[model samples]
Target: MKKRLIGALLALTFCVPATAGDITPRLSPTPEQAQAAYLSAMFLSRYHYTVKPLDDALSEQIFERYLKALDPEHLFLTQADIDAFADTRKQLDDAILQGRLSIPFALFLRYEERTAERLGYARSLLAQNFDFSQNEHYPLDRSKAAWLKDDAEARDLWRKRVKNDWLRLRLAGKDAAAIRETLDKRYTRLLANSQKSKSDDVFQTFMNAYAGAIEPHTSYLGRGSAESFDIAMRLSLVGIGAVLQERDEYITIRELSPGGPAIRSGKLAVGDRIVAVGQGDGAPLTDVVGTRVEEVVKLIRGTKDTPVVLDILPADAGPDGRHTLITLIRDKIRMEEQAAKKSVLPAGDGRRIGVITLPTFYEDFEGRRRGDKDYRSASRDVARLIDELKQDKVDGLILDLRNNGGGSLREAVDLTGLFIDTGPVVQQRRADGKINVESDSKAGAAWDGPMAVMINRGSASASEILAAALQDHGRALIVGEPSFGKGTVQSLINLDQVARSDTPKLGELKVTVAQFFRVNGGTTQLKGVTPDIRFPSAFEGDEFGETRFDNALPWRQIDPATYRPANEIRAILPELTSRHATRANQDKAFANLREDVAELIKLKEKRNLSLQEAERKREKDSREARLRTRAEADGTAGPGDDGLQSSERSLSAELAAEKAFKARKDVLLEETARIVGDEVSLLAGSKRLAVGN
Candidate 1:
């Protein structure tokens, strides 16, 4: 296989692009980057689950994906600029294979030029008064829109964009003078960030373009990112404890580390955008709208106990929304903080349902390797938690895996063993078509009574493996929405291992090496583990999760693994579903949650918003009113009487938001407990009937 792979790569003709215009690059690719590029290409081509060739077809894909990666919203780079690089459209494969990065670097130089010009134009518009009374609409999502035809078209879009930016602040209650200063500083900072782009940035972007063109999960981890990944693995992140991603011009929160300040404060959430950041109290806010992700990370990261204040644009709030200031002290996220926690909810009739919230399938690999008797692992932690719950005399259990973005695979398998005797839990199929089964080798069950596993769109990888095993074994009822649907397994290839002694330190290649499946013959790749009883979800259709990625692998099935089913939950699932529906419809919190989710879905589907101030105000007011009503219904304090329209930071308002946030989170869990209550009742009735028979 190795010989054949090398032969295919060598068969491709390597070529180079001519020097691009008189424009001098602020940063140029080094020999190290070239070597990294070649190494990434070779590894991705050989080990990636999908075996597409490195030819013209993939080259064109790389070109388009690279353009998208640079300007995802099509806000910059005119048609003329795109046309200038037409010659290199089908040559990226050859260039990347040979470690020649002239074309990509040249393209990046042009992108940098365009970015500076655009920001300059945007800043120039700050002096002019926008006619907010005019009935114009700004396209909120331009990801699928066509690129600008020329410089004239680009300026026109910028005019509207600048107008929209101005109006957002105005509606949020900023004076014209303050708005002008804020926007000017924002654009200036953006231009400065553009000029600060380095050679490594260009290489990382281009390599990711090549990687994402093949698969969504696979990518090249540059030196900086590689170091961050290592730090996270060591469980010693210091800062706000938020995982951020660069989306369009904003650094958006992607995930929050469990037990971290972000989650503890309950102010930040997935999808909130950090617009500006400050140090301590009353420090000057540094606008980070268009800053590099790593740069923003540096700004956010500091010594423990130092406070960082983030000016946040809440996710539900559109680009034209109010900003809230959230202050959090920097602290290290330790292993003990991320350990599993348990709680018990009364289910009437003196019965209790135990809930175990496992943030990730974590394990102390170093401790285990050193043969430490007290090595921390998800299975071990959960086993101890189960013992505590058993001592509490719980009648049922709920394994809450919502927002748990997966972790140790060994722990997932071992955790499965706790509820089932030795059996195959999951299967993996490699690129070479070799299938391997991972099974639970232990005997006996831990609290094998009525149980359910709760999952959501954030649950993935190891989480999917465990949920699938439980569902397939008929050991637990899968509840809530479908999981993240990441069935492909990625293995990191350290490029430094293949480098010569004198070669510059290299980065790593995270490639999709295999696809995993459930034991019941079906792969979870695209179609994640579907719940037997689904709850009302904010996400609909293919709007989120793995289905959102066009390059994601397709779902398929293989031969089922040999295993014995424990208890048939399917037999009583329909009855459980009916009971859940009846209770959820009657419950006030559940009804409010359904309404909130429906509103969120609408917001997600909205692609355009009125540029008119009056119209926008009416819309914003109506939305905030609903939020206030939802909070009132939940018996929690909300954004005061004026709502979240105020941009000023208020201790009272912050407290209200925290209360509302916690209440919203509990809505789902409370309903899940009710469903589990139904399970306990049904199972009890079934056994009683059996005894009578």
Candidate 2:
């Protein structure tokens, strides 16, 4: 998970009595908070998915995990810092019980100081003109690198870092002055943002670390964050449809929701920072740097159809560069956006099959509580789409769950009902090892015709459940990369609910209370659901999924549930594999995807980056060429709209959006269509053979 940036008005300071720095620190959780931690621990040990003792060994593990969490890249904390905190490494468990969080707080103060010092060093390097002509290599990903012995080693690293930063910008057509200016502002803002961490921020960070030590998905939400989580669970809000989060002092777009204005407009993207916002024509874009993202949201949000302009710093661009302004007309949950929508893909055999792209398994809990019959959810929308597609006489259907991080679990169960005719879909194993089967209670299948379920690394949780159900039942052909293997179910336990008195609001604990299993008794925990037909994953050899997590629950299984599979596709997998191979070799898009994946694999191995100006430029040019080729092949709007992580220039939101939407289409869907067509033919052939026999 990306580091959740906790920031607000830097001006508002939280007072705490302490001795860490000139600014005293709030070094302990409140009496209620301490109680909350204990209550949470008791609940976790008693009711979590796989309970474990809060023993000395667990405490030691938690301590190390917390330290690593503080500095995953080994950038801020040094060896000395690690040694200094080693004493408390085995003490966090005891401290949590006592409501004393002084150790984590102290460590954070040191991290803040060290971070500020690094930024200071970075700032100082801006004065010295960089000599990129020197032959040197700077490490880009320092996750595996060792912590520095001292500040001198750290300063040397920072100097190279500054040079690398300058070299990259210069290669990207930025002048020396411009590069310096960008780094100056970036470092300055970064430092200022570091200082703005309040007690809530510290508590949230430490508690998250504490909770994460138990399991990756489990977390303790502070009062503010708990409220935010509530607001986010709602499906509709009038805005650009871009989820923004505070990332390194800049309000950056986190994810673009399918069918949202930002997604439709195409200008905004994940990591693009909103530097400013404007309302109406000719209105000046007001700078939003250092402002609370909530405040920024208020500024950008308005009544439906109102034009909002955003001055954005393209994701990888320098801060000093001129920003691109994107104009969007916000709407209140536009029917097209967030709703399950369908498109038709025609195969070479002249058969048209419908593809339903489900971005998330979203459910309107509030509307449902209010008894609104038309409350939106993934199942209902998909059911309606299925009905529409049936009217079109489509050959088959594809559930496109690519990039679909699962939402509501109930939605997944209900959606599975639309396919399977009254059978068990998934089984939940609780902490006590009791199994509860969630089955499709409905009598008949919504559409019994041939179907395909498309998935990728981003398809997770509820998405996994749906895809697995369809696959396990042989109701749908599973296509694409391995799904994000999240097998655990998180249940929210309000700490305040545990308390009887009216006091300061204790936060909530999102704990992994149950593990999900397929009806076949196979657990999808660490080794997510592997598709029957595989695509060359760009994620190959990378540590990005469940298996990469620290102390993740291991793969396990129990007695198979008592339910029969609809059809065992395993028998035809070899033939399917051979056919897929033949098709991929003949297809240009698959060839490109293979080459890109190979390049990615090679790039992953090449960690050290050349700092020589010529080498850097050559590398940049090569990358840009690849991106341009991909853009041309994908027929996207521009180089930026292609799947490249970095781009040369800023793009207008509208243009960017157009190309982005275009870029979303690729060989994967086309192949799935062909596969679906093959299934249709196979079904027809089987019927004829049966009749003849």
Candidate 3:
């Protein structure tokens, strides 16, 4: 198998010839560091999917990506400043090979000055008053916006930015003094964070830029981030088990740990902006905006069983969205907590339906390697639940993979084997240009009653594998939005291990080592698996997928493996599609969802966001009113309102979570159960024998 992996050989790529008198860096790498870089370059060039040349083109891209990473919002560096680094850009290849970090350090020093200047301007706005009535706009999502021509243009942008910040807070029920205080505190904290950037941090940032240009998954992990990554993997740290990253002045929750307190709470969600954090009930939720992530993280961390209240602004809400306070008990991640959870859904004819929400494709590799008799994995847990559900005589099953970012490749194969009698589960393409068919040679099906798999944009990697395999085998109907397209495999290589370094730590590199393909030879790279019954996606844009990266590995195909369809889903897709549309039209929640999705799309398309307080307030009010009306009809409260018909107490995190997981009102799940019911009907309607009969 190892021999099948092909390495691409580049004639001119071994090393760049070192020249004398290179600009000395402020924080230079040692000879050992230089060797690590050379080794990494060679490893990536040979193994990376693109095998892009190490010439001037890639060098230019590395510089561009580096700059973008540091100042993505283009608030700091100007167009003129970028142009000044053009010569430095071309010399990156040589710099990287020769262990010269001077160019990147020079750029970073300029970035530091730029940040100080921007922060000073922001702080200056606190002393001045602005008219809330002015019809102004702010370019909120300026990721693609051109850099400022000069400092004057930047100041103009920053002025509106200041007003926009003021308006958002004001709309959120703060007064002028409070707003100024918040902005002042935020800027001061930000300035401090800027000052704290170490040379290692800058080096990691620069290296990641180079790595990311190779592929989206490839990244350089600094010592701090690497340590954090290790902690997350071990699941030992106690806190709200949510992975977060800084995005445009907010710490956004990326993925929730499957069995963590966060996921079980079900109140916290991906893309939720954590604007504030506080201790157990009664504490004021202090705003965390513009604060260093570590400071925010420290505030959230606490002892086990202790509650933390997070004031979050959900991603889908308006810019001045209602802050939803969610409380969660801090606890270590337990396997049982995160394992496949089962609940019964109602079928139309007084029958029960089984729904298994698998948060991730988990596996205890160490236990398995030690040959433990009772090892935990997604397949094992799911197989047990299937037995219990079958005992309950469920008419059908729905496997919920929503927000499942995926894990454990072995589990994806093992889990897929539970459904099919015998077939290939997935195909893996290595650097050698050969495809490895990972197969299931077993001969018996598991539960096999009418089944449906539910997924969304967050479903990725192993999640995509299982969904694509089931879909390919005609075993289960898939539901929800297109899955997150992250098919490539990442291998973490510690750079310090690459070249022995005792004095200076070299951190680690997460390199995209391989690409995953469906058993049918289709790659789930950028174009994730299309659900059989499509649902209106909450993530209306491409911001959440592998395709969002500028240099993501392109989707490719291989020869179809020898296989046959196990069932006839294609024949019933028309019937399912028709029924789904009809139900969506009649279902009020579904209708509301569709409208929400449309609004989100419009928001995504807008190049500029309104800074005018009245306009912003109008949009926010309209959205809230619509939601409140819907909530009233359902006999529940909406945003900023308690769930009870009448109550003195505010919403607790536990109650809020229970309110959310009320399955009947979960339009997505409701429709999923209905779809599974349809699949059950299809099974009954067909002449073919029911699976596992």
Candidate 4:
């Protein structure tokens, strides 16, 4: 997840505390903070895989990153403010090495001042009536927009912004008085949150900026952030199963955990911005814009079986789009909920196709360590499922890994063992140029019939490894969109453990120390695995993978590992591709999928929104209607299904849910299955012809 430039004001004086109406002290770096900086510099320079020098060039990148992190939308800081800190760009290396951070802290304080100014101006604008009839458009995504030259330019932008905010509420059926009250409270809270920023926040923000400038995946986690990471790793977070990151003053959903309420509800999506949170049906919504991600998490977390209402700005909806209120019950997402499951679809000529949807490549590390015979592991589960499917007389299989953001690396290699006899699966290259090959030595195939591995943009890391290995060995036909290119591996280094100082606490630095490669030699870094049979993708390559990151590692190649092809799947590609294309064209569900993908692409490309009230309302209503129509056609719940929903289920309920999912019209899955069915028939024909010859 991309870290947000969170936290507001910095405190300068260490011993002083703020009283009511007193000027809050500016944030400054302490001796401990300086020690951390020096240590971080040493570790990153010496140990990071990329080995980038902490020189003037890197210092400049860090400077730019920090500035952008502070004001991503260019709403708070002006060009003057940037110019004032121009000289510090190249000098940051010296500052970091010497443990001096006054300039960085000063810049953060300037941002806080600007935020207060902008919010005050916005509040003042709420008192007056907006000319909503004007046809001017507001830029929705201003991350790449030019910085404001002066205060006048900033005010003009803020004026349009205030009008846009008001217009959105008015179109959402809120009264003028209610809109006014909400805006007032929102602005007040935003200002207060800015003032409430602590020294740790500033240190974290700057350190992350430094780390991110070197590599996109690297980050410095504070104590609280570290604890959250542990909670997420343990899957103990009792909340709406949504992974959020603060960006551009909004708490945006980055990913959804499988079997989580956020995903099960099907209302929330990646890139959606959560603007407000309500405790229950009767509680008032607390505004979350410009708030810290930690605080937002606290607001969303609740006891199991309790309801949480979220006011969200839909990802596909442009800036002027109406807010959607979705209610979901909090619950713990168990490993079983994301385990591999099997289904059988009958094909022509008694060719039954088995589909196994693997959410993530997971394993019970502790259970395995304890020598449990029946320990929960993706490979074991999949092997068992394959056995069951074989007994059901299935001729082919489809490994559905659409949204599996990979988990266990060992499981990936072990899972590969189920297909190939024995060979190297993947190779890892460390910072010192040492390459280690991870192989599956165990022999014998689990179910080596005609098979396909399905992946999408969200399929990453270990997913890419497994898919690439299969593709390399000709073991399975790869299908669907390109995988998420995330070949680099990161390890968290606790600063306190390695620090020379006796300081009680420091932070943790997650650094990319190695990169993994496919058995075929190429790394899935910037270039993910390309499918043998491609499908229409709603997400563009540059918008949704490693390529989206500014400083991600580049794809590289090495000497291919010695491994024999498992089958001659590539020889029959032309026939399979032709048949799949014909079937996709004739399939109504596939056509609908293409149309929906095209619509989503268009929506994602929308950069501006009509500020005119009537025009905006028409657009929002039309979009909503189109979505509702699509949902109905796809056999999903429409806007009318916004009541409280829970995904927690009993054994019977789980079975029912699985049945319903299989019955649902998933165009992509259906098409993939048809492609596999075509392959099965084609291969069978080849075998018959061979026998006759």
Please provide, for model 1 over 510-627, each residue's C-alpha lDDT reduced to its tens digit, 9 standing for 90 to 100.
8888888899989777788899998889874376789889889988899999886755477888899998888887888777777778888887778887888888888888977877
lDDT of 3 by residue, 97-179 (tens): 67676788788888998999999999998999999777778986877888988999999999998887777777778787877
Which regions of candidate 1 are displaced past 4 Å?
1-24, 237-338, 370-374, 500-504, 631-633, 636-665, 685-693
What 10-residue stretch in candidate 3 is worst by lDDT?
641-650
Report lDDT (CA) for all predictions.
0.81, 0.76, 0.77, 0.80
Candidate 4: misplaced stretches above 4 Å? 1-32, 185-198, 230-352, 363-377, 384-395, 499-504, 617-665, 684-693
What is the model-wide C-alpha lDDT for candidate 3? 0.77
Candidates 1 and 2 compared by TM-score, better number: 2
TM-score of 4: 0.74
Q: All predictions: root-mean-square deviation over Cα?
A: 8.1, 7.9, 8.7, 10.2
List the candidate numbers ranked by lDDT, top first: 1, 4, 3, 2
Better TM-score candidate (1, 4) = 1
Q: Give the TM-score of candidate 1.
A: 0.80
Ranked by TM-score, the better of candidates 1 and 3 is: 1
